[model samples]
Target: MSRKQYSKELKLELVKKHLEDEISYWKLGKEYGIEASIIRRWGHKYETFGEDGLEKQNADLCNYSAEFKKKIVLEYLGGNITSQDLAAKYKIHAPSTVRTWIKQYNNHEDLTNSRKEGVYLMAKNGARKNTTLEERINIVEECINTGCNYASTANKYGCSYGQVYVWVRKYKDKGIEGLYDRRGKNKAISQLSDIEKLKAENRLLKAQTQQQQMEIDFLKKLDEIERR
Candidate 1:
């Protein structure tokens, strides 16, 4: 026998009774011919994301296979499939992620180069950088000119808003010397010189390390298979 699809209102109404302890779940499930879990889900959703979660029936959610998704995206990036065609084929939860992956693949060389030279130093956390306080002052001024506010610049630079604000004032009056992060202020961000650069480089290195490990493990497995 096929299961019947009940409307959201009926589910919510049943959930209300369950919450009140007005009826046993077994009796309620038998009465409505729905699973006990469905009733429990309504209660859990109410506790978490709240009533809006009530509208989502599991069937509405997508369940694309990860391997299939990667294959389709890679083929599309190679010009073997159209964007709309791929979208229809694999019901991606967010198609934009595919586009981003393709963009990253295309820019891999530039990204790799950026990671190697100390140009990637912004991504490193507590390392000492040769770039002086003057350069930081100039970047902060450029950031402000580009309409970056104190908070955003702080988050980007991985420094406190207080530090960025003081630097901005110093850069305004005394120039680069004024913006020089006072030592002992945030020994970390100050020592590193460019917190954002350091963070980005470290992130890239971690990703590369993981990828290298996976490749090494795969090669080792392949060698063992060939010997067999």
Candidate 2:
């Protein structure tokens, strides 16, 4: 899906929420229509320039250039600007260039931005995430594209392999709503009880097999004595 942009008022409101500790960075990004990570950029905007961070920003922070990428990013952040709108203004060929720039801004400092477990910035400040299913469809596609096995995908997403398959397969069949965890909606599908029952049955079967093997061994010993 294409990204949505935020207005000046909206940006300021989200920043207020961040400063107030009322909304987490990730949630604020969702509310303001920016990526969760971009809160870091907003925070940097606040830290370097104070309240001016919420203003319609312009210019670059890294090279000390007055021509900040902020204005272009701000428009795109509103989530309405089309890829064509972006290419013309930013003189970039790809819409994803704008996305990469925003990601850069987000890792800047906005500590208020929320992150999941195992996501960290490398030396280059680029991110590597230990996948969680915040966006189930997207994550499942990633796993498929990467050719990872289901168990591996489960490990990455903090779910069981069975769950990864279930969510992804449901999304493939039914679309986004299918990704909403149904574990709460139906206990029968939750599998915990079923798994426990199977475990109990398996224990009983194993004990029966062990007893039969002991009997067989005893009979073999008796036969040996008879032969002797």
Each model's lDDT comes to 0.48, 0.47
Error of 2 at 103 (Å): 36
lDDT by residue (1-228, candidate 1, tens digit) is 976666768877786676444586677898988788877666554432223335634332224334554565567645556556666666643444345334434323111211222121122331223334545654465445323344334435654333444455554565434544556343233354566545533543454455556556645744654555
Q: Which sections of candidate 1 miss by over 4 Å?
A: 1-66, 107-228
Return model 2's CA RMSD, one decimal: 24.0
Q: Which is the leading candidate under lDDT?
A: 1
Candidate 2: residue 72 lDDT (0-100): 58
Deviation (Å) of 224 in candidate 2: 99
Query: How many angstroms is residue 206 displaced in model 1 relative to the true structure, after the best TM-score fit?
Result: 20
